[model samples]
Target: MTDILPLAQLGRRIMVTGPTNAGKSTLTVALADKLGVPAYHVDLFRHLPHTDWEPRPTEDFHALHAAAIAEPEWVMDGNYSEILPQRLARATGIVVVDAPLLSRYVRYFKRTLQRQRVGALEGGKDSIKWDMIHWLWHTRGTAEAHRKLASETGLPAVFCRDQRDVAALCAAWDLRLSLS
Candidate 1:
């Protein structure tokens, strides 16, 4: 008899949630690349046109997510509380990436710098300002709250405390698939 692998049994829908600059998008992209599935950034649905900070219609967000979930396989990344229930219902797995406040701050700063320097962000405009960074750190309380809610949801969640943990989880997933 041979042992079977767990990842071989994984379902298609997945959600990646985390604090700001915790690398949720990076993780989603990596997973999608590995799994050969589509990955959706919820921010793209939430952001309004020509405005970096302005939000789109909440109903539109819900509808967009609903449509995405209709797909057979997808990796959704974001921390939109209003759509949590719908996402949770459709997600086969949840990955929560967490890091210290200082670490998140550093990551956000570096990402902003990189995006600004590369002129790759929306509208070919750099929206990250010192005040925005300050506001991000100040408003981190919301991410913490979402983390708690996710924890309480009792989903089959993998919480990564830092980058090492994230790497380990990815390695484990790969190993399990290879063994299978």
Candidate 2:
């Protein structure tokens, strides 16, 4: 939380990274809600029309992300490799949302099932398929890779390993803003 204060005070662009179902979207939305700034969910930019998992063109993805981060205040959420350099370049901070592997897998399963039952997914996309569940599990390694990348990118980052840390971070962020 202390690590986040400076970035929030500065109103810097940020990228929230984490494993699937680790609450990256939740945290990004919360931050944007608190700061009253725009938050871009990269999934919105990535997912193609009428397709479940097909990604958009690389050029289009970069253009879209470039446009989003061009703004003064924004928090972007995703782990698209093609956009990482530009994202890291513009990011004032990074928050890595990490939870235990077992916990994350359970969350992933529950979320996928919930989405399927509701016929809704992120970005108004259709419910995810069973194959997507396998993809989510594979994403576990990507989260670790991003943690390393964030460390090397030199952005001020806060890694929350569990729900307690997440709550603590939110509470501290609230306190900081109140005192400010």
Off by over 4 Å in 1: 1-6, 49-53, 116-124, 139-148, 175-180
Q: What's the CA RMSD for each of the models?
A: 6.0, 4.9
lDDT of 2 by residue, 58-122 (tens): 78877888899888888777777777888888888888887767777776566655543111234
Q: TM-score for all predictions?
A: 0.77, 0.79
Clashes of each: 0, 0
**Which residues of candidate 2, in runs, are more than 4 Å off?**
1-10, 49-54, 116-125, 175-180
Q: Whole-model lDDT for model 1 versus the true structure? A: 0.68
TM-score for predicted model 1 compared with the true structure: 0.77
Candidate 2 accuracy as lDDT: 0.70
